[model samples]
Target: RSLAESLDAELLMYLAQRRITPGFLNEIDLFLRGHPELAEYTPDFVRRFNNARPLAAYRFFLKGYTRPARYVPGILPERDDQITLPHELPSVASTVDDELVDFFDGYEYRYDILRRIDDQVRALCNFLRSGGRLTWTQRLLVGLTLFGNPVDAYKHYEYNYQTEWLPHRYLPEHVVLSEVPKEPDYSVPTARVRTLDGADDKTRHTFLNTRRKMARANDAGV
Candidate 1:
């Protein structure tokens, strides 16, 4: 309830700026309050209501939210500004102070993350319409981090799946089909070529005779 209230407050503020009606807001608020379990797993619930504090935030929300909170939490970074997985490896430099990119790009690196990034983002936006709370794992998976990594890429999958205790979702069938190409191969030409090689006078003579015979046959037929 506490988490849902906070999310609803933030959502209402956002909607108001967009001129959303009071009736819609009230209905959304009611809907969020109705689904306590989903509320606890919604990304809007985490980002708006359960923003974990600094070092604690990094540990809890940023680093998988395993740490116990000792106090109130602060706001996490925005999605656009959030760190992404390294798209390219750094070139070699011999200098002592040259820094290398971190091995893990902050964006989701798993296959699942790639598949569900858009879907999770949409779901998060919808969840915000109602306002709710998301569990630590849910926050990591469904929030801005949804673009960070897919389900299969999570380091703590087995542990989280068995112990984290929440509704597990399968990858939608569309994900498997979306990136596929539909057109048949028409890029290359497929014509055949024939070659004639002359090796000796006898061979050339035989060819000439055959051609003459073919011409004679054609003339006779005509």
Candidate 2:
């Protein structure tokens, strides 16, 4: 709820500054309310934003920049711009590597893009802490994720979807390391009977005989 409210407030601010339109604000609000994808990681954002390293927090934008980040906005095209992902992406083949590939997959650009706004929030928090002044654009950005930093915030989604969804969907179930089995092989029985409810006289007698022998052996200190 706090996150939704913060985003709405940011949208309003952006709308006021001409950085975003009322239509853009409405669409963003709808996106936040309707989409479960972004919500899943909001808790982490709130948590990490509070304890982020002061210097690391400042450098996180740069420190985590493996390549120029691509930006995408949801609100206004004029507000849209691409910053190279901080690092060079690895090649995509039989496998995808985070070290090489832009983990965000070019989804960051927008009029009020989730990623860009997220960055705005972190930069604002850092700026305020340092007594730095914000321009209209910067103020609008900071509100997007007032309690979160972009580097730590968006990565949760990338990691979650990549780890939780990709292996199960695109690759074989065995390839995915999940808390529970992604899909079960129907050819195998889900359950097995290791013991029988009833036994024949021969089996019962044999069991009793073995128990008796063991008891006698123990008694004799064998």
lDDT of each model, Cα atoms only? 0.34, 0.34
In candidate 1, stretches whose alpha carbon ends up further than 4 angstroms from where it belongs are 1-112, 142-222
Could you tell me every candidate's TM-score relative to the true structure? 0.20, 0.19
Model 2: C-alpha RMSD to truth? 22.7
User: Against the hidden true structure, what lDDT does model 1 obtain?
Assistant: 0.34
Off by over 4 Å in 2: 2-14, 46-222
lDDT of 1 by residue, 103-215 (tens): 12464333443334344544544564466554555554432233322222233242232232222222221122223343496342222223365323333334566566445
Q: Give lDDT for model 2.
A: 0.34
Model 2 misses residue 221 by how many Å?
71
Per lDDT, the best of the predicted structures is: 2
